[model samples]
Target: MVGDALASSPGGYLLVLAVLVPVIGMLAMPVMGLLRVRHAASLAFATIAVGVAVVGAVGWRVVGSGEALVYGIGGWSPPLGLALRADGLSAVMMAMAALVIALVALYARPQFAAAETAPGGRRAFGFWALLMGLWSALNLAFVGEDLFNLFVALELLTFAAVPLVCLDGTAATLEAALRYLVFALVGSVLYLLGVAVLYARYGTLDIGLLHELAYPDFATHAAIALMIGGLMAKAALFPLHLWLPPAHAGAPAPASAVLSALVVKAPFFIIVRLWFDVLPGASHEAAARALAMLGAAAILVCSVVALRQARLKLMIAYSTVAQVGYLFLMFQLTIEPGVPAWATIGWTGGMLQLVSHALAKAAMFLAAGLIAEALGHDRIDELAGAGRAVPVSLFAFGLAGLSLMGLPPSGGFIAKLLLLSAATLSGAWWIAVVISVGGLLAAAYVTRVLKRAMAPPPEGIVTSPVARSRELAALALALCAVALGLVPLQPFDLLAIGRAGVALP
Candidate 1:
């Protein structure tokens, strides 16, 4: 009985802390800054440490007990009251968020440190506060068991993220931030309309209740379609990804890392919930294939576009869109009507791609920031002296690129391999072909940057030295991405821990 699995297990209070600590840290930032600006940074770091530990503890409990951890809020259970739950998938996401945010903080510390009452201190404090808010929203999205609550998290996420894009206050970045805001608000409206439709029909917004109550009807199908469509816009999947490149490329590197690696994933996570958890009986193979086709387009088209980008950050931004395409492929690969999707190799591959991409992309962006810092600009053709100026950053970029290219002993390799195996097993040969072509395209673009970066400097070029600690921070993330490839090439049992007997939609 999965019901027993949601009975407010021991150590469930950790979920409350996971969400609360970040909110508290965010609220406290300004107050601490009144006395000393640097205090805000100290508090933010402390919050990160505590949040990471809380997530680690929750993950430990879920894995050790081999069960989902659930906490009914205010002593009330579902359909009437809210609940927070951490299944293995949720645990993995929370852990990934914690790790990425922590490492990003490490990389951002020197730039965003409010050590003195300089003009930059205010922006620094704002960055830390917004980051905490974003972390809180991400945690809530992962743990919340109600549809409306997840929407609230999404709203918080959008609000926190929009300001980050224009933090530099440049005219172009401001325009980009405005564009991102418009798209995000549109997605929110669509998602909210779906939620309203669901609540009107089902009389509840709780996901578990909807799982049992929802049937394949006009209302159900309409709501699910609306919700998924909105999420696709937010996730920056192809055709809807217009705002992503400019916004991500314009933002500060740490903010860029967060937006690419985590912010987009939140909405996609909700899409997963809507598809598999709330609408388990609503599986439509045609719809699944359609989503996969979009993914294939994203992979092929974006990779080609990325290859032509002149700016390092823009190329990485486009690569993010392409990598996201891999996630949607899981729908077609794992959509067995009666089988739990998480038990499949396709599902595991999709998730591994998410984690590895988060790590790799974060590393890539941070390294790009260092390269720009040392070389004074991010122009690809002008990057001749970058290797000599920021060798660690260049090496980190190459290491992260290895994963993106699906090279051996890297997470992306294992993930794509699993996806290919699933496609072949299911006789979805077209998907297998797309996967291969995507890898080759990714390789071409990644090597394009590496080849330019490793070349000798042109005459009269100047460079500055970047902090070794910052370069090491980026390297750490890249190493983690590669480390994921060490896991055995098979469906992960851990991902299936709470999904046993759960039907796929």
Candidate 2:
């Protein structure tokens, strides 16, 4: 069994292997070029399978022991050597990312098959390699203990994601890619500056060490502000979201799925780690309120924008911005001391929102792709009768939309409920109001598309059909989002298991 292997293992090398497996596959792509097409497919598939196994093994070890799995690099502990740590949250994220990437690879095969046989046709191959690279980088970002190591991982994620924005080499896409690049570069500079300040003050870059060393001094507070501000820009929170709609809507559907559903979350995850783990008891009430305000604006303003969108993809992109706003609301709700047990509910709710959004958004984007393929366009008004032509894709889109709208028995519904309860307990009345209004706006946009799709076409408009397997892939993810609601409504001890002993609060 995997547990036996982990038990017998000497160090955190397995965690390292989990991150490296995909990177190694990416590196071997050129070497595998001379082989048959089937050989390349087999190599990539086997690598992904092994990655999933490694993540599962790590997760089993973490949840079974109720302690984090720690591996110190080069036989040296933290402060002198790098450390890799896997807690329940990190393990779950790694597993989810692996599953999504593997499925995307399978789905992209049919779409990108034509490029595989052409001379110098490395674009599709590059896309696959970069997808694996991004996966590995994300896992490393989740688990790496050193700030510098995380910086490297974040850079890798950025490099991998930027190219995906302009994969088709169109002028508009290239402009969007450039905008994303510039904005993300600004974020990187600010983040690095914060790291430098922290290192100077604490004399170490290890998160655990810094957490123990941190004090509520001017330098620390300033560093925290700078770091969080940087992450917010990258995460596209509120006013900083100028780059998201264009970039996400312009990218290829599979790429958009990964970019919106996964990439933006990476930076936000880091911000969470910084606040909860590094700052501990430090209270930046004013700053936290500022973030919450931005989140409220995003929810109100972007939801309206989504409602006004003429294109299905742009509408989804706007909805993503609004949903991201809800995530930041957890910071405001959970940070208060006298709040009820429901405050913890907000914590779990925020995470559920993250996971459910990832699955649901990916499914929605893939369904949109299939619809565009069938109808030859994605204009919402012109989409009449699309549901009849591609019922499975429309069904998948509707199911995912149900989650986005926070409807019954869907993960999004549970997440929003938890957040609303927490806001009520914390006396954050505005947040509660925003959550309700946001759900209503989501319902409006979703119903608008469904109505058009279900109606008969005006004239003799006929659309092509999509492949069954592709539609099924999207439906599967949508179903997963809905299934997450089955999880109990407790504080989710698994999320809290290894967090208690950490150096942060």
Candidate 3:
């Protein structure tokens, strides 16, 4: 079923269109120079909405027909041509990206409006172009079956995202963008080196082929190590997270949403593919534990740092680093020797972590953005009357924080619960302890922000009112994160639909 789910199909033309539509819009912006930002944005939104529907249709077919949708470019199979494939995980990720990007587009309508004095303004046009490019790259990353294809997707994603980081063109933002570029370039080099190593040894870069060819050899291990290390840096998985807070906090709100919610997850998804799908046996228990240890450190350290943050946006950014750490624990917990990878609770938990975090973090960032707009700042300590001023935004923030804190009826709670169960069952007591401690630390930071936000303010606090529709947009995204907790606690068969014949040990 793993191969079948990813097998090429005529219906897979939808995936091609899904990725290409956004790229087409981005390229056509210059031609549409006469179109105002609003008109151009409308066209981009309409086109991308259709692209999203195509992706949804593919996912619907994948789920209903119990097979992944695949398109081999030019009707040629691997070893001769490239391919796009969507399994359970890929479908879920693409769908998530589409939904988040759409809602954010709605939220950004007012934020990116060009001043009439500057027709075809740089900031507005650049933001939309970068957004479309980012969306295209992400869709390709999810569906790309070849390692080289994924590499290109990652590069496109980086190029699109790096500019958004420095959109303001301030000296500080420029430095952040340059730093992000340097780290990302280093990661790209390491990842490319691994791809080269694999191609030299096996003569093909297709993940499905690599699954059959990879072995417990020194070169194979070396390649995976390099690739995973590179992905960790890109994922901002602690220690290498120096560039994350500044870049994420500095970018405009919409950019921050996509960067924090979607951009980083692309590399982490590749890491998952490399470990479980491509080189399962090559990744041993000891190596998994090493990654999990680093994750634990991130959860411990970053959560505390978030708690100490003075600015609301900086706190949220640091929280993202800590949230990323939890996903790595799936590496440790999914090591049951006799069980298939997708059948495990840890596997489901990890994927849940990915989807829920995307929704919740996007909501959190947007809420912070609204707060900053209203108050002209996001100082956490001065947020005494901000909540009363913008109740809806604060409410959205609290809901998103529930997921981050792993509170009841939130997706983060469900994900962490499943992971905790898996750790206890596996007798990984240390991991269980780490999960509990991480949750507490998460709670501390969230409560810290809420405590200040809810406090009574001194006299003479100016409160600017935010648009109700924008508030609804943020709230809706937060509700999606919370809604994921309603699903039953069991192995998600949807995620397992593609792994039936994989050579898991």
Candidate 4:
């Protein structure tokens, strides 16, 4: 299987650095003997900025040349060594993760400030380090060309993420973290089982190679089922979503943002690669429809659950489950015989939803955090004065809600509209109906919070003012979500990049 390395792209090395920089920064924190809060924060942000730059360069190269940036490790071809490949999807996702993480880091700085008297003064350092580690893992997941390498990335992501959920070390947060760890491990085991099955059957784990080699065999079918099922568990889709709400609502807002916005999406990303790129034909149409139906269930059930929440954070957390369902709905709509999945409207629609939701949900969570801080609690009924106390954050929250509601001029609007159109065009009436109802349900929950927030303060409720920087960070993310709608209604060619022989989006 080892041979002449696939011809390297002009900027392919950047792909390796994209994954390595954060790992290096995470490691260097100890090596450089600079774990102080100030030093940690500075190092983390600088590394993230560099990561963003690298992602931008990769995106430019991919979009300019219309191909993937691939680097075979040590100039060795796959099956002997590993390869890192960055396509348009990786570029966009890497950039999005970097930007969201940077904003989250800024938002978290004051919250995680190390106490002078705390043991070893590690709170702040831990936060920054874990953030960097998570970033590294996310980049690795996005660019990983092998199932085993992606497994390693997924494990790293879980390790870094679980700690963030319980940064305060409270019993409740600890319990939530433990629950997350346990379920995520279940996912890992299943994924690994499928990986082992695939490797044993085909003698390779490279995704591109598997795409060509895999056939409609029992082992192929079983591995795809197990792998996709495992990924869904990690992704916290409906029915398997029990661990997400408490973990997200209980974690610090910044951690919640990272978890909800980026981490969950990583497993889902791999699931997509497995289905559409690697084992598309091995999985039957019933499987895709089943996934879409589960998504529809998540949307309907979780939206109602979110609406019932009295706490702002809980509401946002449940809403995340609801929104995540939309990602799965695209599966049935995008994959039809003789059509490259990437060429379908569902492809762009689903990906845009992922990006837009990341930005919007991060903004909403930050805004919720700001509100919680201002009021000393997150009781929705008592948030009457929040609009007056933190108008910027409140505005940010509302703007993000607009996206979640699929309102016009927001990325969510374009994304859902495209998906809904795809469903209708493809004669999937039930899917179109579900998408419509999900949007309405999303609007209901968002407005429920907005209504309470907009109410006048009840007899002088107390509220602390939010810092301008924190408020701006939230607003910036919300705006990015809104701005995603500016891409023309027609197919976005940039999103279609590197999907060889696929019709343009």
Global lDDT of model 4:
0.88
Q: Residues 39-146, candidate 2, lDDT per residue (tens digit)?
A: 344567778888888888888887777777887766677687788888777877787787777777776767665445674245677677778788889889888878
Q: In candidate 4, which residue ranges exceed 4 Å CA deviation?
A: 1-7, 34-38, 115-120, 280-283, 503-505
Note the Cα lDDT for every prediction shown: 0.90, 0.83, 0.88, 0.88
Off by over 4 Å in 3: 1-7, 34-38, 115-120, 280-283, 501-505
Residue 134 of model 3 has an lDDT of 96
lDDT of 4 by residue, 130-190 (tens): 9999999999999999999999999999999999999889999999999999999999999
lDDT of 3 at 40: 55
- Give the alpha carbon lDDT tens digit for every residue of 1-505 in model 1: 2443445788888899999999999988777656554566788899999999999999999989888888887667887678898998999999999999999999999889755377787788889999999999999999999999999999999999999999999999999999999999999899999999999999999988898888888998999999999989999988899999999999999999999999999998999888889875645788899999999999999999999999999999999999999999999999755667877889999989999999999999999999999999999988888888899999999999999989988998999999999999889999999999999999998888888888999888889887899999999999999999999987787777676584333
In terms of TM-score, how similar is model 1 to the real structure?
0.97
- Estimate candidate 1's alpha-carbon lDDT, on a 0 to 1 scale: 0.90
Better lDDT candidate (2, 3): 3
**True lDDT of residue 407, candidate 1:** 95
User: In candidate 2, which residue ranges exceed 4 Å CA deviation?
Assistant: 1-11, 34-42, 115-120, 338-343, 501-505
- Deviation from truth (RMSD, Å), model 1: 2.6
Best to worst by lDDT, what's the order? 1, 4, 3, 2
- The per-residue C-alpha lDDT of model 2 at residue 281 equals 53
- TM-score of every candidate relative to the true structure: 0.97, 0.94, 0.96, 0.96
